[model samples]
Target: MKNVKWFAVDIDGTITLNGNGMVNLNALSKLRYLARLGYQVVFVTGRSSIEALALAIFGGTTQITIGENGGVISTAPNSHKILADIDKCRKGYEILRCELTHVNEKSVFPRMSEVVVDRTFNLDEGNRVFKEKGQDLILVDSNYAYHINETKINKGFGLDSLMKALDIGYDEIVSIGDSTTDIPMFNRTKYSITFESSTKEVRNTATRVVKGENGDGLINAIDWIMEQKSYCEII
Candidate 1:
């Protein structure tokens, strides 16, 4: 947490448990405290831009959010910047939809820039088909869902946009996530934290791995960071 001014976090599976929905109250309390300590706490998530806005408003964030697996920026409530062209995304979906299994629009969450479906589908084949079509769309899997976004759109890109908007540098941000999509953000920041339940690759790539899982893990990471900085006022 040294030199850190912002905490970019993934929502589902990072700050929220399997049944906690958005996040547990305890985790949200800790996040609110962190924001009160004058740090920008951002939610870089695979959830929709509207959900990101709700989380941001609740956490008192610096109005910077990365949603849709880095394909969308919720710059303000009810307003969003979509990284992928809507027409291209629709076309790609039309092609990729046929390759999926046990999934459809109903199984997917509403999103601004990309389509998010359950992991029960055939992800590998979907990617292959999209590539064969020469579409710029790419499929990214997070902790619990798969996001189809533009080729260059990812957590890192969304974070870069947020940082630029805030006039913040990479070194001042701490990126925490629990999925492969987070690897890009890990590459963009100095402080990277992953949950214990994260994939082996993510844990190995992250700078630190907290002991607990999900929301509890996030709290643990925050406690460790605060300890490193020797600041206990949040308690």
Candidate 2:
């Protein structure tokens, strides 16, 4: 759309080829092209802010990144804002560790705001435990891992934070993702895109569903956006 100035994209299943954490060169190149065309591209992902920041630095996108499923927002190499309470996440993790079997932390980059664990336990059951215990924690599956974060925090919250920081409005952005964690982001933006491989919920939440998967899907989305009459006029 003509008002669109920023592209908020999920990194894992959205841009990474096959969701294996491999960078999709073609998709990355498209993002770089968007940057060259004066559109800001921000990486919004479930990975650690540090990891996502690194990708932004090398991927030729904006320097800012939203990571840890809206729990962390990193703007520079050593600068970041923590939006979730790590102490609460740790408490939830302890409770889960004691009540469930095989619930262990996953080995990942150092996280500043949340706890991540393997997808070895029932996510609903884990959240139920939190509810019964009067905890404000929630367990969200990114399809890559399970994250323990504050119930109020989500990608939409992260996007809001970014909007405030950048002095932009939600209507000026388009979100693209392929997972449940991305639903909040989809709801916040006027235009959202997802792949055919995404879950029904994700596909339904998005404004558009592309036929391609992963990196291919991202390329298709960019191409489609570029082909729009308003977008062409703006360019």
Candidate 3:
């Protein structure tokens, strides 16, 4: 691509095909190719490091992962060094409790870390469900699968940390995601994109909206970006 050194992609609906429970081999290979071409690919997802780690292991280390919306990151999940850790996470959860009087203490951090404090619930009955049983946190939605942590650390903060680590300005980044939490990155970047299956809140904020849903849309968008004369110059 052009001089674009870093690529921030939302993992759930964008990279892995939301709800499929499988990573597209073709798409994963393309991502690995992009990394080989010298672009820093970042998987920005609402999933926690644990969930992201599962996908990264399955994808075979093609790109770095930013998990818990943006709260934590690692080159790979099992690795000890965190790319991002909002120490204020616990504090954020404490605040969430004050604002949301009835929310279960176990589910507050992971859910509120990245986005606004909307609501909370018990693990088994949430809109987004965490796959790991026994963990008090679970996403009750179809869009993301993250174990609830003690803070709302999420994609927005995660992107900012990644940008800081790379010493790149916000204007130099390209953020692509498909949910409400992706809004922060969209608002901060020079170019922001959302998949066709993205929530309305995400699509409305994007500078461009790709045609397909899930991983298909992400692959198409990345291909389109690579075709642009300006983007081609990045590599």
Candidate 4:
């Protein structure tokens, strides 16, 4: 019942958005209020810093974010750190061949490492190849399957690193996420809440599931935690 001192949040579906790049102002206000209430908020997302940083601006300078499935953490611009550098995921010949050969009728297989940085996209060339293979290729700032690319990085590893850095116990924290990728956090956190909009697997593992979708669910969770503070506190 203590005030949720640590909040590990997801970005895409939880905060930033689904199809739009814009954010919900009410959510931002809620987050700011939580901070003033003494919660340490951290963004545990699969996005790369390039994409996630834009979203973090909504939290102002004090916000902390985990990107590239926890391969990167930036407490501030100059404070960027790689929590887990799973470079083995870096594109290689054998991996590319395997990825291409395993491609399904509805899936795009991209040699993401061979990706060409372009004006309009992060990995245009990679997406092109995936498309040529008759797969549905979408360029997300994150690869939830990054472990497929390299066994090193993933949402779980990132969450572990964030907890170590903050010197907070998992038992005192509440984590909220909405993806298969978020499973790692769900598995480890003391309390896990899945948004009503999450995938089936994510919901199945949740300790609690909120009613609203997207940031609305997150805001509800935060309010619930703050309400608990009237009974408990963690020092």
Candidate 2 displacement at residue 34 in angstroms: 0.5
lDDT of 1 by residue, 30-54 (tens): 8888888898888887777678778
What ranges in model 2 sit over 4 Å off?
229-235
Which number leads on lDDT? Answer: 2
lDDT for model 4: 0.61
Tens digit of lDDT per residue, candidate 4, span 92-168? 32334455444221122222221212123234444455456544223333332322223345677777877787776
- Provide the lowest-lDDT 10-residue window in model 1: 100-109
Better of 2 and 3 by TM-score: 2
**Superior candidate under lDDT, 2 versus 4:** 2
Tens digits of per-residue lDDT for model 3, 1-235: 3445667777766766555656766777777777777776677766655666666566654446776656566764455335333344344434445443455443332432332233444434432222222323323232333233433334666677767776877656788877776887677677788877777877889988888875778788777777773655654
Q: If both were scored by TM-score, which would come out higher, candidate 1 or candidate 3?
A: 1
RMSD of each: 3.0, 1.5, 7.5, 7.4
Per-candidate Cα lDDT values, in order, are 0.80, 0.91, 0.60, 0.61
Write down the RMSD of candidate 1 (Cα, Å).
Answer: 3.0
Ranking by TM-score: 2, 1, 4, 3
The TM-score leader among the candidates is 2
Off by over 4 Å in 4: 84-87, 97-149, 231-235
Per-residue alpha-carbon lDDT of candidate 2 for residues 13-70, written as tens digits (9 for 90 to 100): 7789878999889989999999999999989999998998899898888898999999
TM-score, candidate number 2: 0.96
The C-alpha stretches of model 1 lying farther than 4 A from their native spots are 19-22, 98-103, 107-109, 231-235
Model 1 residue 209 distance off true place after TM-score fit, in angstroms: 1.0
